[model samples]
Structure formats: C-alpha cells, structure tokens
Target: MGQKSGGYDLNLFANPPNCNFVCSVCHGVLKRPVRLTCSHIFCKNCILQWLARQKTCPCCRKQVKRRSLVYVNKLRKAIGRLEVKCKNAEAGCLATCPLAHRRRHQDSCPFEQMACPNDGCSMRVQRWALAEHRRYCQHSAQWHCPLGWLQ
Candidate 1:
C-alpha cells in the first residue's frame, strides 16, 4: 500500500476479502494482521517484534525474507467476511451487513474501536494499535523507542 508523491492513491486497498488468522501474540482471532512472503499472516506489530527478536516466521518459525511483510487491509478483506448491521445498538441495526462493513464497524463498534488522542496522529485504530500510538505520540511524555514506531 505504498503511496505516490503526487496524491494519495489507495488503489491497492480499494477492496478487501473476509478472513481469520490466529493472533500471533495471544493466539486470538482479533490481532491485527499482516502478510508475509511465506503466505502466513500474523498481527502487525506482533510479527515485527517477533522478527526483531526471532527473525523467523511466527507460524512456521522459518527465516523471514526481506520486505515482504505488510499489513492485512481491513477494507480489502471486509468485502467477503464482514456482515453488516445497522450498527445502532438501540435501533437494533439488524439491517444485514454488507462486505464493506468493517470500516463502518470500526466507526461504529461500541466495544471494538477507539481513536488515538494524539494531537496530530489521525489514526482510528483498534485497541492494540494504541500502545503503538502512545509510544510515538508527540504529545505524550512517555513516547519512547528510537524509531517512531508507526506502521
């Protein structure tokens, strides 16, 4: 999902498909994902640090190759796996979900999402990305790591 300089071209992420992979950390379904050259998928930061420390695929424990790691695009995957609902709990949003339901859910899930409060970090990521956010937020006194830690 690299972007060109002229303008934001999100063509690669124009769509998504449904999926499920074990959370690399807790082995949960909810860990955010990324694809590796081995075709194995794992949570974003999970594999990064996993690679940093292990340098092997979390799934197969094989040596990870170069730059093949990338985030699993939610919008792209939602097309197949997501089930849409009205998202309004009280309204009983039983409208029957569509493939494009994730972005809406991220914006609507009462218990699944939250926006980063960093003054300029405009990311509305899942709860896990919060630790990644706070580590790099310019406004947070506790921001650490030599790297900015954004992905």
Candidate 2:
C-alpha cells in the first residue's frame, strides 16, 4: 500500500522524464513539449523550428502548423507515469526507465555492445560507431587461419 501511494505521489511530480521518440534535432529531451489534434506529440520548440524550416511532422508525414498546435500537459504527465526501458533491441539489457526520457539511457547505455567484424578481432564495441569500426577495423584479417585469428 505504501509503495502504491508513493508511486502515485511520485507521479504527481512527473517523476520520470524520458521519451522513447527520436528527436528530429538537437537529439536532446526535446524542449517545450507540444501535441496536435491528431494525438501526435513532440517538442514545441522542435515543431516550431521544424515548421520554420519545413512544415510537416517528422514522425508522421502529415501536414502540421504552429496555429493548429496545443500544449499537452496531461499527456506529458501521463508519460511521466510510465517506465522506460533500454531501446537496444537484441541486447539483453533489461533496464527500466521512465517513459518520458528513455532515449538518453539507451543512447548512453554501457551494456549496448556490438561485435568487431574484424574476421576474428574478438572485440566488443559500442553500437553507434559499430559500422565505422567494422569498415575500418585494422584487425580486419585478410587471411583466414584455421586457428581463428584476427590480424
């Protein structure tokens, strides 16, 4: 009972503030949150700036404008009530974060690792730069030995 009460009380303050949505710009916690009549929501500043540069929702290819926009505090608060989890699929990371701001956790998560495609480099690298490393891995063994060697 105490835990439940605490959960509700904590949610009263927007306890969690992580979002799973990918930011269109800045790639941060999207400043000035906003929502549309279509139920699609995004950062107000992001939308406005996007509208200034181009008029359309990044997630949905629907027409959007500043005039048809409205603040969605209720939704935002509701989002805060949710738990966030690692976005790194395939990985066994079971971390749970808030619904408002899980992106940051996944982006900076340490468990997220990838194999170094260096023939047999046997190195675990972060997910983001995995492609570059794989492409230019010095350990990219040109010769394949029977004993399973990298470079």
**How accurate locally, in lDDT, is each candidate?**
0.53, 0.59
Candidate 1 residues 1-151, lDDT tens each? 1212111111212233223434445443333467788878765656666677887886787788648777667623633354444434343333445434545654645444567887766777555457776766666656665675534
In model 1, which regions exceed 4 Å deviation? Answer: 1-20, 30-32, 70-81, 84-151
Question: Which pairs clash in model 1?
Answer: 15-76, 16-76, 16-77, 17-76, 17-77, 18-81, 83-97, 84-97, 86-93
Over the stretch 73-118, how does candidate 2's per-residue lDDT look in tens digits? 7655655546745655346565677755666776777667877866
Of candidate 1, the 10-residue stretch with the lowest lDDT total is: 1-10
